[model samples]
Target chain A: MIFAEQLTKSYRTKTEEVKALLSVDLNIPKGEMFGVIGPDGAGKTSLFRILTTLLLADSGTAVINGLDVVKDYAKIRQQIGYMPGRFSLYQDLTVEENLQFFATIFNTTIEENYSLIKDIYEQIAPFKDRRAGQLSGGMKQKLALSCALIHRPEVLFLDEPTTGVDAVSRKEFWQMLQKLKSDGLTILVSTPYMDEAEQCDRIALIQEGKILMNNTPENVKASFSDPLFAIRSNKMYQLLHDLRDDHLVQAAHIFGEDIHISSEVINQQVIIDALQAKGHTQIQLKQINPSIEDVFIKLLMHTESHEQHS
Target chain B: MNNIANNQREVVISATNLTKQFGDFIATNAISFEVYKGEIFGFLGANGAGKTTAMKMLCGLSTPSRGSATVAGFDVSTESEKIKKNIGYMSQKFSLYEDLTVTENIRFYAGIYGLSIPVIKEKTAALLQQLNMESQKNVLVKALPLGWKQKLAFSIAIIHDPAVVFLDEPTGGVDPITRREFWEMIYSAANRGTTAFVTTHYMDEAEYCNRISIMVDGKIEALGTPSDLKKEFNSATMDDVFLKLARNAKRIGD
Candidate 1:
């Protein structure tokens, strides 16, 4: 439903011209939940703005639902629900008023699209008269999302929707998106959480305005080229230092209970031998599959070093 | 770890029947816990689980409505100033001054902590070199990348060499590599006998802590090491443990 070819955007700072998006391309089919996973300042907001027709790119063309972004900006704005990363709602207005306001602007009434936002709106119904600013973080989020869906747009673009949310609420928010997707709505969301990336049908790992890898989550994890292993012992803290100190080990990071290490030639015996020599007892080592987080870290390191050299 | 020697180690922070009541609403309901010296303690809860209320009491930012607590041997109820002096605080929201140069920020913080001019100068140089940001020492903090800014904020948080440090989501929204690097920095500081009290949403980070307390509905639902919590909840990872405890929470802290 959304397609962009060679999309580019840049911003002029006092001392530099920062490229926010560079030759970026994306193709999201209808009814697919596409995720743009990246850290803060990774140009997620820029890409979202371009797709939602809120901002124009420096060059290149973008099409949404078969309409060119620049030419059909008005229609795109009417048909897409965009939730900004920063909460942007009428703070002084009550929760009910905000939803009514959004619906009114889109030339629809809340009752006209009641079924679309019913599941989400019902949670905050008791607080209908509460001011948007007075609601707690989670309540405000639910209200904002309810307003976004009040218009029942064909496509939904949420930028960093789960950035600062707690764990349980984060899960709930994703489930809501899944329901919307099942209703045949094309969804585009961005977040810094790696685990949330798996919830998407496919994800584009964006960093520094470039999509480093674009594919299914499984494919992204499977694309990890390094030999990965998980190691843990009694001296967990010292073990990290010992593993990182090894010249052969490329990266050693803590992943849950064990330390995941990547290297060129990773032998379970060699790692155990090295840790044992460092007085790390109860050493457990296992050849492990790379998670999406591991793949992203590896890709990030590659790009970072490449930039340094250039 | 403190879990194994629970009764023997020095308790850096002790909250005994601590409660905070706002009219009829109980933000914190008689929560009790102990953080041992040199241990990395993970404080976690849902949005309105009273985690912040409990943390504010521990940090001496808010007076408790009932019970008592002591941070670094200073009574939080009466010796709040002393407690603040003995502990360092850093939150991702209100971090280093963006308008200030890196050197100026570090020097200003150290000076506030009562460090002499010579000590501040020496520590500033060493910190810049260790972070490999000597070239950017004079640059505005806002000009630096997010990763560098986070790392610098963390280093400066512990500049006073306080007895314990409080970190509130220090690694939020940063890249994975930088997040790991931040953890390594935490591990290094803890190794030097400086205790760390951290609050984070990342379950993998919860695993790195020496002990964790999962709060639910104005009370601590579970408190133990990562492995013990997993076993008690019959879960595999810390994420599962957190979900099992926090899923039932109904209250949201403001």
Candidate 2:
């Protein structure tokens, strides 16, 4: 279990002050997978660092497993495993050596907590003699995770664990996380990818050091207020331009091959007629449900415009 | 609307039996493909699947051990200098001078391309206005957000107005909205007759490409329009198609 109240942090440089975290309030239940979703420099790293007791927050408080992050830093460290965004394992050492090092640091051995990371370690066990630096991206990640879980920590903090990885590796990494979650470990993960947001039990969409929305992916998507449509044509660039010019369309942005548009009225005939008038042929328009990316984009746009107006 | 129209487009890049070997390792094993003008071509593969090696050969950054290829109207092996001149390159790493201001970076790159002072000034102003970053023109590149830096790097890459551009995972680690906006820029460039050769692991991004080639174990396993590939594989999504192709790879993370 983790709890935080009015957490704030700021970095003051010679030129300007950067507000890394602004009143970040979070409550992650025991054994729940909680995701902190945001772009880079959006305070996800700062929040994770504060909660892991690696960095002190400027104000407010946080507790992990009923242990204060500041007052009980040592105990909290023992209960939680923190994987920074960058790989922090000893690259020069062999995979087995790295695991042994981490296990020794926690005053334990690999045999004691073998079950916690057995699934992950088995994947990299064949290359136990290989240097950690020589392993592939996916293999390195698995090794790092094995090292982290060597002491059987109650909670896992993974920051952008899948970033810059190939699609298959990313998928595999998520699968591993799901297995870990099934074993009753509370997981707190941060990533900028919206597709990964759906994997978590619940996610908080953070931006500019603030939380925009926090809920289940389904609930967040269901909260989309406008009628959404997916439109595709032979001339996609032209179609995007024409759709944006239409007064009835409130938002028109490309989602993959098709343009996802939000409109005030759900009139497919009118939209088709307008595109036809614009000499766009082979048009396909269908009302569709919203995804987490759609909701996040809408929320982000609203926040930007609100800031500009204010 | 139909995939047939793509066949009639002018070919900007063509390769036959492109292969690269590192001693006992065959990094790229006789891969062949063609990219047409004014189209977004997606080159996709798993990590260590030889995508980067293939891209380097195409970009003239690395030489093929045994193969023949033509890029931007020049032979890749012998006329790489000419090929480099007529193509733009952007990678996942922001390739701008972080210590320099926006205008300064623009001027610096323009100078490298031998642009005159007036032309550099004119283009710099237009780029800033087009990106709507006039307010941050004097700010240091490090001060900008990751999304803005990516967009700026992309714009600067194509500022030379090359015939084609190669982007290696250009939208990695950015949010969906920023990725969407970056694609809008790519679409605009393609509209102006600039061919795009991009490699990305994002399956959703693969859908946006006019055509895609999926590589596995140093060989291209599938190549077609997204819909055609989906139909051929009997899959509904690019992710599924990729998994189906990559599952047969003999080597992973090599």
Candidate 3:
């Protein structure tokens, strides 16, 4: 549903330049749940802003639903539901009023799109009389989503929709998104949460204005080329600090109580002795599968190494 | 594991029959929990599930309609001033002055928390060094990356050396790598005996906490260590555990 070719965005300050997005190429299939996973300045928001026709790209071309983002800005806006990272709703207005206002802007009534957003709208409908500002963060998120979907757009662009929400609400929100996807709406979501990346049918791992990898979550995780281990001891805090400082342990960091490590030197016994010497007794070390987060961490470490070598 | 309170590990914050009502709607149902002296306690729920309302009460920003909460040994209802003095907060948006330089913003927040000049200087210097962003201290807050800004905001929030630090989704829009780094900072703070009460929707992030309370429909539905919750919910992951509890969707127990 969305295609971009060498797209880029740059902002010129008085003193220097800020390249928010670099030359990027992406193709998202229609009705697919696509996720853009990245850190803050990885250009996820910039890409969304450009694809939704809210911001202009510095270079390259992007086409949404076969219409050029720059040439068919209004048409793109009409067909896509864009919920920005920030809450951009009428705060003073009631939940129902905000929905009505957004519906009115699209020349549609809330009753018309009521069926589309029924699941989400129903939760906030209890507080329909309450002002948007008075509602909690999760309520505002649902209301904003209802407003976005009120027009029954073909594609939904949710920029970090689950951020700052509670765990239950986050799960509930994703369920709503899944239902929307099953109903044949092209869903594009950007999130910093690595676990949420698995929820998407496909995801593009982005970092520092560049796409590191783009594929199915399973395939992306499958590409991890490292021997991973989870180690822990009574002195977990001290052990973690010591492990990270060890030369044999690459990517040594805490994951829960266990310290996740890459067997960089491949001398397990030597590493264990080093840990024992560091006063980390009763240490438990076991080979483990890499999680999506672990895979990404390894990828980042590899990229850093490649950069240093180059 | 259920009632570790009597062990006397020094409970910093304790709640009894904590309830908050806005008119007929109960924002926080009758709930009670305790936070240890140095631990990261995660308060999680759907949006509008009363996480912020409960947080507001803990931060002394709002009063509970019923129940009682003692934060840093001060009554949340009566001794709000003392409570505020001992606790620092960083919201999701992380309200820093964009127009001000990074150093200036830190100084401003430090002043608001009633810190001395020498203390502020020492804390700022140590914070910048720890974050490895000392060179960017003179730059305006707007010029830094969102990750750096979030880290700085967190650094400033706890700069007062408060007893408790409440972080409401402090790493919301940052990247996964940065989020991991952010959690590192949180862990360090918790290790120093500062109770970190955090609220977030990310389930994996929830797993990182020492203990998490899952809220649904204005009430805490589940609370335990991640592993225990996962096992109890018969789920392999935190996400499944959350979905199972949230849907109220008919579990073996339910």
TM-score of 2: 0.97
Better of 2 and 3 by TM-score: 2
Off by over 4 Å in 3: A74-79, A89-153, A264-269, A302-310, B1-8, B21-26, B62-68, B216-221, B248-254
For candidate 1, lDDT tens digit of each residue in B1-254?
32223356888999999999999999899999998888899998887888788889888899999999999999999999998878888888888999999999999999998899999999999999888889999999999988889889999999989899999988889878778878778878887878899987767667778899988888888998888898899997788889888877777535
Q: A193-298, model 1: which lDDT tens digit per residue?
A: 8988999999999988999999999999999988898877887788887887775488887775677888888777877887788787787788889999999988
Models ranked on TM-score: 2, 1, 3
lDDT of each: 0.87, 0.88, 0.82
Q: Give residue A110's lDDT in candidate 1 (0 to 100).
A: 95
lDDT of 3 by residue, A148-241 (tens): 9988999999999877665666767888999999999999999888878989999998876788889999899788777888886766566767
RMSD of each: 2.0, 1.8, 4.4
Query: Each candidate's chain A: what TM-score?
Result: 0.96, 0.97, 0.94
**Cα displacement (Å) at residue B92, model 3:** 2.9
The Cα RMSD of model 2 versus the native structure comes to: 1.8
lDDT of 1 at A267: 73
Q: Regarding DockQ, does 1 or 2 come out ahead?
A: 2
Ranked by lDDT, the better of candidates 1 and 2 is 2
DockQ, in order, for the candidates? 0.55, 0.58, 0.32
lDDT of 2 by residue, B1-254 (tens): 12225446888999999999999999999998988888899999998889999988988889999988999889999999888888988887758999999999999988887789999999999999888899999999999878888889999989999889999888877766778889889999988989988898878778889899998999999999898999999998889999888877779585
